[model samples]
Target chain A: MTRLELLAPMTGRVVPMEEVPDPVFSEKMLGDGLAIEPSEGLAVAPMAGSLVVFHSAGHAFAIEGPESVSVLVHLGLETVSLKGAGFERLAEVGDTVAAGQPIVKMDLAAIAAAGLRSISPIVLPQLDEGWRISKTNAATVQAGRDVLITIER
Target chain B: MQVKAQAYLEALGGPANIKDIEGCITRLRMTLIDPSKIDVRKLQAAGMVGRPMIIGKGVQVVVGTYAELIGAEINKILKQK
Candidate 1:
């Protein structure tokens, strides 16, 4: 069995996935993971892998890391309606990235001004059978520096 | 995956019931002509992870990262009709 570690995509208070406003995320519909009420505007690669999915609206992105574990970082709640207005993409889809590398930058103030919540959900999207995940107990975490999730197979 | 898409389409009340469908990273969001026509049981059988969230005329199906592919497939089926 092997284990994979995922770092926080942005600095923020780590909250249980259930705390995310979206039912899809809060209910773990997509997969099990956590959310971060980001205090910083920058989002980084949680682990080294190919940048697989980068939403055109800039509200979300996913990275496929080792052990075939894919981590999705969704920027905010209902921010997709903003249509990329408060986001800047620093990396393109298919780009090979390293852990902690900056992939996107957000204008948190703009999101707030638009009356959107900036609570970002970090999701597994898909969890294969036999794989288990654990989250950090820390109330807050630093982007790319703190471990957010650990997966074991 | 195409088969799953077809199942998802049927679960969403088929092409005639769909007004628009788009995929975000984790879910397929659709606007349906008749939200009441959606078959929640079929959606769960077709691999939908969570309950189909229906808000007014809009419905969101959480299909993980395959959301885009499934959305495109459903759109293709819609186009063919």
Candidate 2:
């Protein structure tokens, strides 16, 4: 079995997805994953892979993950409407990114003042069957730290 | 604001073009069939906070706090049509 690591994209307390206010995320409609009560606004790649979906809106970006899993990193609630106003894209679409590499820098204060929640969800929308996903319970994690999600294949 | 949201969806290729709808705090994340059908200028004129993008066969629109509501509205509009 191969073990893959999903790194922490930002420095934050890892919360169960249920802690996320939105049903879509909290309920795991998007897929099984954890939510981060972000202390910083910098979003990074959780695994080294191609940048498959980089929304210009800056609210979200998805990295094609290792082992064919796709990871969607959504920053804040409705922060997309800010239109990149407070987000600085460090990487472009189709670019290859490494785990924990800085991909987007966000203005946390601007996002909060705009009345948006900064809870970021790191989701595996296309999690494959037979792959086991495990997470660390309610802990503060640093960006680029190894394996927030330990995947057993 | 809801009316504007509807209009914005219409501008972005309508509900029929939408394949899947989900939302984050401030954006209505959707997978659409065609990205070319979107009218970015109209959405901008309507005071949309951000430009829509075609990401991995999906369209993400920044609709602020009303994102979830708009996602529901898109479904309703799709059902109606």
Candidate 3:
């Protein structure tokens, strides 16, 4: 069995994915995961892997690690409509990233000013029947240092 | 298993119902002419990851990382017709 630990992509209060306002995330439509009401604007890589999917809008990106495990970090709810206005891409797709390396820098104030929720969802978009996932119990987590999600397969 | 774009288009009420469609990382965001015509069961059968969501004339199908490819495929089919 392979075990993968996903670090918190940003410092924030960790909440269950169900609390995200958007049904796409709260309903766990994409996959089971957690959300964070970010207290900072910087998002980091959740694991050591090659950056695979980085949205042009800079609202989301995914990293593929050992065992083909992928973790997606979405900056905020409906931020995609912003079309990269308040987001800055720090890392490009295909770049090898380590857990905690900065990926995108978001302007939280601007996002909120645009009337969008800044609660970010960290999801495992791909999972198999043999995989098991565990979420962190901590109310608040530090980026790159705290284990946010654990996956085993 | 990757879902065939043709299957997704059919599940979404075919190319005629789709007014606009785009990929947003993990989901296909679409504006349909008749949102009610979307078949959730058909979408599931087409390998959708979770329940498809409808908000007014807009429908979102969570197709994970392959959303871009699927959206492009659907668009190609729409252009052909």
Give me the candidate number with maximum TM-score: 1
TM match of model 2 to true structure: 0.68
Most accurate candidate by lDDT: 1
Candidate 3 lDDT, B2-73, residue by residue in tens: 248888989989878999998887789999999889898998888787777778998888887767667877
Cα RMSD for predicted model 3? 2.2
Evaluate residue A66 in candidate 3 and report its C-alpha lDDT on the 0 to 100 scale. Answer: 86
How does the DockQ of candidate 1 come out?
0.63
Rank list by TM-score: 1, 3, 2
lDDT of 2 by residue, A21-129 (tens): 9666776765788988889888889999998777666777888866787788888876767877889999998999988899998888998889888898888774779
Model 3 clashing-pair count: 0
* Model 1 chain B worst lDDT window (10 residues): B63-72
Enumerate residue pairs that collide in model 1.
none
Candidate 3 chain A, which ten residues in sequence have the lowest lDDT sum? A22-31
TM-score of chain A, predicted model 2, versus the true chain A, to 2 decimals? 0.95
Top candidate (DockQ):
3
lDDT (tens digit, per residue) of candidate 3 on A55-133: 8889999999988878889999888899889999999989999889999999999999999989999988757768889
Q: Given candidate 3, what's the lDDT at residue A108?
A: 93
